[model samples]
Target: MSKVISRDGTIIEYDRTGDGPPIILVMGAFNDRSTGAPLAGQLEPDFTVINYDRRGKGESGDTLPYAIEREIEDLNALIAEVGGSAFVFGYSSGAVLALHAAVKGVPLSGLVLYDPPVEGYDGRLVHQLTELISAGRRGDAVEFFQSQLVGMPEQVVVQLRNAPFRPYLEAIAHTTVYDTKIVCEPPKQEELAGISVPVLVVAAEEMRDKFKQAAELLVSVLPKGQHLCLEGQSHHIVAPVLAPVVKKFLLS
Candidate 1:
């Protein structure tokens, strides 16, 4: 694993693979570098993939008081390690961070986002999550996050509960608060207008209208942007379909 120290003195750990322009994979909640392995493996041949554990999970350091800017700094540090500029692909909450980074003027060649959760769409969803967090029920918080925030079906949630990664998901479930902070506001069309980098907003076929709207909103705001929907796919199938799209956009 390669390591880079962020400006705030946190040690970030990452796995580097393939041989081309660096593409950093920023994971969403409930995912680490390992969780994205399958998708990363597929893109390894075309781009130098940098898959890293976000702070507070896996091999990265987590100091007190988690702020969204620090996570942005982590991305910057990773980009610096990989030769100053890169194409970035982010999923869910990580996508939110990537958008914020791009708006803040990080030197990115391109960006691809998959279903980033932004506030103001379905206020009831946020209310339910806040209630769960208030009750101090971490498991319920995780479930609400998957079902409500991620819009996963009941059957999918049940299957995941029985899956091997259940423990890992449970462990980082509390980090939803961090995700909430980063996505507290919906994507601003004006903010995205300043980003000159190419962007691709992807959505799953089964994603709700709100998600599709969010993707469309991003496409509208970005100076050079396009939108694609993965046919016959849902939130769970995002990584596999997304890898190819990211490869094509970044490598083209």
Candidate 2:
């Protein structure tokens, strides 16, 4: 494990592997660096992969009165550690965060986003999650995210009530507020248009239609954007199938 201090003095922990061009993995909610370990392992043979814990989770440090810019700064710190530029791969809501960072002019060589949830986040979700977490109902917060926000059925939520990962989800439930705030107010199309770097928005064949539609729309809006839908894939990462596509794009 390695660390870099962000602009606001927060220590961000990361694992670095391989020895070539740099690529940083930015994960979504319900994830720490561990969620990205498999993909990192696959990419490390050809690219130097940096997998890190976003603030407020894993071994990273967090600051109170969180602002979205702080998260951008966290990513900027990582890019700086990699010599001021790197390719970035963001999954789920982390993809949204990456787009926002690119808009704000963080140095990036290219971007790859997988199955970004470009729609369906509630405008009032930040307030609701804050209330639940502040009231010490972390379990409820987790369930609210699973059922209401992510649209999991109640039966599925109930079935996973005692899941071994339930506690892990609840442990970082507070950061769900961070992710909700990020996706709830997505980047403007005009802002997206201003990004001058190459971007690839990827979707899975078996995922919801909305995901494919969102990828196509994002591609249309981005000046250098392209879209690809993988066969027999879903929202989850299948690193063996994905790593080659990412490698091709980054190398191109």
Highest lDDT: give the candidate number: 2
The numbered model that scores best in TM-score is 2
If scored against the real structure, what TM-score would every candidate get?
A: 0.87, 0.98
Q: Model 1 off-target regions past 4 Å?
A: 119-136, 152-163, 237-240
> Which residue pairs show backbone clashes in model 2?
none
lDDT of 2 by residue, 90-132 (tens): 9998999999899999999999999888764768988999999
lDDT of 2 at 174: 97
lDDT of 1 by residue, 46-93 (tens): 889999999978888876577778888999999998899999988878
lDDT of each: 0.80, 0.92
Clashes counted in candidate 2 amount to 0
Model 1 accuracy (lDDT, Cα): 0.80
